[model samples]
Target: MFTFLMMLLLFVPIGITVDLAEKVGKMLENDVPFGEIAFYYLDFTVYFANLLFPLFLFLSVIWFTSKLANNTEIVAFLSSGVSFSRFLRPYMIGASIVAGFALFLGMYLAPIASQGFNEFKFKYLKKNKSVQQTKDVYQQINDHDYIYVSNFIPKTKSGLNFTYEHFEGNELKYKIFADRISYVEKDSAYKLTTYLKRSFDNGIETVEKETQKTVQFPFELEDLTPVEYAAETKSYGELLDFIAAEKRRGSPNIGRYEVVKLKKWSLPVSIFILTIIAVAVSSIKRRGGMGVNLAFGIAIAMIYVFFDKVFGVMAEQSNFPAIVAVWFPNVIFGILAIYLLQNAKR
Candidate 1:
């Protein structure tokens, strides 16, 4: 526990420092206050630190436990007739406890903190002001109707030269065109502001609608809640619900969000897997004292991290299913852990 706490405190501050320096450097380019950037960095780094806690836990357990073994304590224990597998029971128990807490934090608390941190960043330090290169944007406000924007600016909640279509299955119902569109937040409901509208019947026929005001009615704007903004929301129930809702509306972004949701649960399992591997690798003492074993453990952990990023990118980009992509690295390492464990037991 002392080792775990020490590593946690040390690494978290290092993470915070690195993030703050990066944020401050970026803010300097925009002439924003270094303190403001530092705050944002701190917020994000806290969330990141929590996510990395499992790695720290695994490292501490291996480092300290291996040092104990190297000092002849494990030798004495073995001489006392304790089987090697039996000797691992306590360490396994501790690993299981850490795994449980890791799951809890990943699936529940982390998402809330992620939401808060993202919101703070968006409000204060967002570098981009507009949506980039959208070929088509579609939204269905009600039954049998949808709106499409060729280009959109999320900063202004506005789209340029938009078109709205109404359809009943395969039949063309009605359509509308606007020079520009925007959304305004109000106490009760959101207002969609459009400069002009041209109504169409039978797909091709168009009729102009004269309006005194610039805004349009019956258009639903997006919810501004953090739950709406964050893809990192915890709670399997909530994620499932959100995925169902988005799928019904035919949203593409929902796929990646679901991927992240599933990954949260899978990531905690790496703690257990790494624990097994570390124990296996560190059991046999080498001439370099504990340092060689420690170096191998860290190297293996780094390889796992690299594998993780590779798969994460594949999940994001290629046609590979995100669920499969995210879990592939874990699957590989789990096999490696099992092999190492068996070999070490001999």
Candidate 2:
């Protein structure tokens, strides 16, 4: 905990300074209130704390354990007949505590912080209108219902070149097309301009056209719009439900959401793995003392981080399964931990 706290203190100021410097100019130009800016930093703290959690745990374990080894404390304990496995008991216990705390943060607190962070960025920092939503989206609203849009604007709750198609057992039952559509949030209705509808029955087709129409749809505006950070903004339960809903909709971003879900579990599991590795590496006194252990620990941490990022990107961009991507680093490091433990014991 001491080492973790020290690392956090060192990083927090730098994080705050960089964040403020990046956003201050835009905030000042937009005349954003002070309270909102403060709230944003609060969210930033939570987001960053969760992100650096595993590294903090790894470094903390290495720092204190290396000190114990350097002071001959570990030698004394072993000389007194304490087994190395028994020595690892307390580290495992401490890792459990840290893991539980991390789990709680990931499941509950981080989601709210992430939502606020992304909201602030999009609202105040982002100047490009196109960045708000994606263009040319296609989604299945249900098993038999599909929707397509050429472009969507979340600010106006509107889209252009919208088409809704309904299929019944390999047959096109009905189709709706509009030159433009806008959602009325207050009324829970959709306004379609230059609307056209076609109904097909037994190979016969009937068409109807309207200049403007207002109608209620079963789907919400969010269903039609593309959200880049959708997974990050949802709590654990909400995330599961969102994933299920996305599956029903046949959304193309399921891989991203699955990655987020898997990562919640993976991050906590990594705490235990990294703790073991840290203890195994640092519980032996080296010729160069603490510097040797610190250097080695930092290098291992970097390798773990590198593996995490490479796999995470593969899951996000390619056909790689998210569960594998999330757990692969832990699995590899877990083997390393065992190997190191055996060597340390000998």
Q: Considering every candidate listed, which one attains the maximal TM-score?
A: 2
**Top candidate (lDDT):** 2
Give each prediction's root-mean-square deviation over alpha carbons.
3.9, 2.0
Give the per-residue lDDT digits (tens) of candidate 2, residues 1-346.
7677787798888999998988789999999899999999999999988877888889989999999999999999999999999999998888888889899999999999999988888888885644334588888887798998898887788889999999998999999999999998789999999999999998899999999999887787778875778898889999999999888888878888899999899999999999989999999999999999999999999999999999998988888998999999999999998999999998
Please provide, for model 1 over 107-208, each residue's C-alpha lDDT reduced to its tens digit, 9 standing for 90 to 100: 777777677677666555675632233436665555676767777666666666677776778676666666666665554332334434454555576655
Colliding pairs, model 1: none
The lowest-lDDT stretch of 10 consecutive residues in candidate 2 is 127-136
Which residue pairs come into collision in candidate 2?
none
Candidate 2, position 51, lDDT:
76
- Please identify model 2 stretches exceeding 4 Å from their true place: 129-133, 184-187
> How many pairs collide in each candidate, listed in order?
0, 0
Whole-model lDDT, model 2: 0.89
